[model samples]
Target chain A: MSSTTQIPFVDYLILDDPPYLQAQECKSCGARYFDRRNACANCFANNFQPVAVQSEGVVTSFSIIQMGPNPYVSAIVDCGGTNVKCTIMKVEPTPDHVTLGMRVKLMTYSMGEDNEGTEAVAFGFEPI
Target chain B: MGTDAIWIIGSNMTKFGKHPDKDVVDLAAEASRDALQDADISLSEVGVLGVGNLMNASAGIGQQLQKQIGQTGIPVFNVSNACATGATALRVAIMAVKAGETDVGMAVGVEKLAGAGLLGQRGPKPEAETWQPNGRFGALSSTEGRIGTSIMPGVFAQVGMEYGHKYGGASFELFAKISEKNHAHSTLNPLAAYQKRFTLEEIMNDVMIAYPNTRPMCSGNCDGAAAMIVVSDEKMKSMPSEVQSRAVKVSASVLTSDPYEDGCQILPDVNTLTKNAASQAYEQAGVGPEDLDLVELHDCFATAELVHYDNLMLCEEGGAVDFFQSGAPWRDGTKPVNVSGGLQSKGHPIAATGIANIHEIVMHLRGEAGDRQIEGARVGLAHVIGLGSACGIHILEKVA
Candidate 1:
C-alpha cells in the first residue's frame, strides 16, 4: 500500500526533461497523431516513430467555454507544423486574453487530486 | 441490371419536440406504420427492418413494431453512428434492396430524449467517480479534454473560432445569420420544433451556451422519429400508381469516417469526409453540386453549415458569407438548403435528425413540401456528420 503512483490522462504525456508532448509520426508520410494506432492515416504505413513535439506554438484557434464542462480557455495551437490541441492556463478566458496567432509555450501542472491524493498532471499552452 | 440503384417509395416522420405522453417504441411504431401506409403496402408484405436510435435502449423496438403492426417475421437490423444514425440506417435499407436481399425494407429512426433527463443519466455515477483519474470529466476529447472539460458545445465553439481564424472574414455574427436563415425556413414547416422566426440580433443575444454560440444557434434535445421505405426497381414497378408517382430515387448514398489527423478535431472538417462522399455521391448520381436544387444539411451548429458550404462545394473557401446572403439557399433561390428548418429550428432528436433530413429532401423532390417547396425542384442532397466521428450523405431524385 506504500507504492507511489502518478498518472497523466493518457500515455502521450511524459515527465522527462524539457517535458513535451509525444506523438506518433508516420515513417512514410510524416503524419502525426496524439493517440496510438496500428497504421498511418496518410500512407497506411505500419511503422511510426515517437517524436517529441516542439514546446513553442501559435494559437490557431481559441474558445472561452462558458458552460457544459467548465469555463476554461482552450485552443488549438500549431506547434511547428503539427497541431496541438490543449487548454490555456493561468489566464482568464476572455477576448482580451485569448488571441489567435498568439505565441505560446507548453507547460505542465497538476490538473486535480483524487481522493487518494494521486495527482493527475495535465499539459497546456501558456501565452508567452 | 447491376445491384446499385435503389429507390425510396415512402417516408414518414412524427412531429418533433417534446412528447410527454409518447414513449419511443410507440413513436417508432407509428412512423413505421405510416411508412408502410405511404408505400401502399401491408405490414405483412415488408421484407426486413433497419432501425436507428442512439444512447437509449431500443432492443424491444423490433418486437414492438411486430406487435403494433401485423406480426411479420422479418429480419431487423439496428445501426447507430452518433448523429448519423438515421442516414446510416437508411443506407442499410438501400444496400438491402440493391443487393436483392430484400425487395422492400424500412429504415426507421427514433429518439425520445426530452423526458429522459439525459444530463443525469449520461453523467458518471458516484461509484464510477472513484475510478476516474482525478475525477475529471471523461466524455470530452482526449488531450483537449484532459486540460478543459466540456461536451459538444466547447468543441464546436473551438471549431467556430478556428473557422474564423482560417477564413479571416468569418465572424461570430456570421453564425447568427446562419441560424436566422434556418429558423425563418422553419416557420413554414408545421412539424418543426420551433416555428417562430427570430432576427439575427435576437439569435446572437440569446442565452450563450459557449463562446460565439447561443441557445438558438445550438441544436436542441427533442423527441422525434422518421422512417423511409425503400424498394428495388422490380418491387417499385409493382407499386400502385399513386405511390409510384411520388417515389424518389436513391441515386447515391455514401458513408465516411474521420481521417486520423492532428488537426483541430471538432470533426475532420465541417464537411466530415464529405469531400470524398460528395464526389462519390455525385458520380453515383451523375450530378454535381451545380445540379443540386436543394440541400438538407445537418446544421448541428450554424457554424457547421457555414463551413459545410465550402466543404460541400456549394461555395468557394471563405465564401459562405456572400453565398448565404446572396439569397441562394432560400426556398425560392437557386440552391435551397435546410428548407425544413434544420436541427436549429427543427430540433435535433439525435438518431432521427439524419432521417428527418432525408424526409425533407424526399418531400421536396416529390413536390410535397407544401409551403416550403422549392419550385420545379429536380434533385436534392442530405448530409449528416455524427460528432467528429462518421458521416452519411444521400442524394435523391424524383421519379417522374
Candidate 2:
C-alpha cells in the first residue's frame, strides 16, 4: 500500500451527446425505416441512404408502468419522418400527464462523470 | 400444412413449482415417461429428441435427458427462445415428422428453477451493464445493457397501464379482477402451484410490486417440465385404429417477432408477428378465431393475459378490460381464457409453459379437463410470447 491515494477511473470513454439513431430511406419507395437492413422493407429496394433523425416527435402510445424491477416512462414516438419507440425522461409531474400525441423534444446530457471527470451523455425525449 | 403426415399423439406435464428434491433430469424423465405412457409407446420407438430450456446451458441437456431415460443413438437437439422454448421445440419436432425425417419424435421442456436461486444465480453472471435499470441514459456498456430492465412483470405492467388508459378504468381494479379469475380457476387444477382462491379485496390489498400490480397479480418462478410425442400418420396407423382415431392433428403452428418500429409502445405493442402468425395458423387450420371454444394464453401477468385477449384477436383492441369486467373470460364465458389457471396461478416454469399450455388445451379438447373442463369444446388455441417480443401461436382442432 502506498501513502498516496490512487483514484479509480472508467476504463473506456463514453459519449455525452445524444448518439444518433440510424435509419434508412429507400430510394425507390421514399419510405423511411429504423432497425437497419440491407433491403428496404417497404418496397424491397436495395438502394438506400442512411439518415440521422433528431429526437422530436409525438407520443403515439404510452404506458404508466407500475411494476417490475426498474420502472420508467415507456412510450412510442412517431417522429414525422419515422416512428421510433423510446423512453421519456425528466418529467416533473405525474406520468399520466404525459399524454398520447404530445409534442416532445430530445435532450442530451452526461449520465455520469468518469474518474477523469469526463461526462458520458445519452439521449432522451421530454415534453415540449 | 402437410396433410395426413404428422400428429401429436401424446402430451403430459410434471407438477410445476419449487422442487429442491428434483433436478432438471428428474423432471424431464418424469414428463417423458408420462408422455410415452399416454401414447402407449415404448422409449425405443422414439427416433428423435428435442429439449427446450433456458438459463441452464451447462452442456448438452438433450443428451443428459436421453441418458437419464436410458435411450441412446437418436438425434437430440436443444432449443431456447426465452419463454417460447417449448413451443419452438414442438414445432421442430412436428416439422421433422411431417418432412419424413423421423417416424416418431419427442419434444421435452424441462427446467430447474430451484437451481436459479435468483435472476442471475445460474450460468455465467451477466455483465454489470446488463443489470442497469431502464431509463439509465448513456451509451449502453454491454450486450445485456441494451436489453434494459424488460423483465416479465415490467413488460406486462405497461400493457395493464395501457389498457387502463385506453379503456378509462382503474388498472389496479382490472388487475385484481384478472387475478381473482385465474385464482378461482386454479382451484380446480390439482397440479397448480397456487390452488387457493384470492378474493379481489385480497389481490387489491397485497403488497405492490410495480404500479397497478401486486404480488398475487404476478406469476411466480417455478420448476418443472412438460413433454409431447409427435408421430407420422403411417406410424399412427400401425397402432390400434382406436388410438389413431384419438390422436389430435397439428392443424397450424406459426411464430412471429417484433418489428421494433417507432410509435410502438412496448406495452400493447402490436406484435405484427403474433398477428401474422395467428393468420397463418388460422389459414392452415381452415378456421378463424371465432371458431375457437377455448384458449390458453401466456398470462405471466394479469396485464399480459388481458393484452393477449386483444392481441390474439379474441376481442378488439382496448376491449379486453370490458371483457374481463363482464366476466366474459371466465370458465362459463363466451370465450373462456386460461381455464387451466394460466401462468399466474398455474405457475410459469418458463420452459415448461408452452407445452403445459398445450397439455391443458389437449385435456380440454379431449373432454378430460376435470372440473375446469369446457363443454362441447371442439377447437382450442394456445399463444406464447417470448423475449424481444417474439410470439408463437398454435391452433388445435379435435378430430370428428
On TM-score, the candidate that comes out on top is 1
lDDT per residue for candidate 2 within B218-313, as digits (tens), equals: 877889899999898789888876667667767787777776443343233535667677877889889988899999988887877777777778
lDDT of 1 at A91: 81
DockQ per candidate:
0.40, 0.20
RMSD of each: 3.5, 5.5
lDDT of 1 by residue, A12-122 (tens): 777676677888888888888766577766678889899998899888876676664556776778889888777888788777777888999998886555667666666
**True contacts recovered per prediction:** 0.39, 0.16
- Encode model 1's per-residue lDDT on B1-400: one tens digit a residue: 3555588888999999889998788889888888888888876667888888885645756566667766777888777888999888888878777778888888889998774432211344354323253322222124434454345666666666776787776677878888889999999999998898999889988877666778888887889999989988888888888888998998888898876555633224544476778878888888989999999887887867877787788987677768887889877777888989999889888988888899999888888889888888889999998875778899999865
TM-score of 2: 0.83
Interface RMSD of each: 4.3, 7.5
**lDDT of all the models against the reference?**
0.78, 0.72
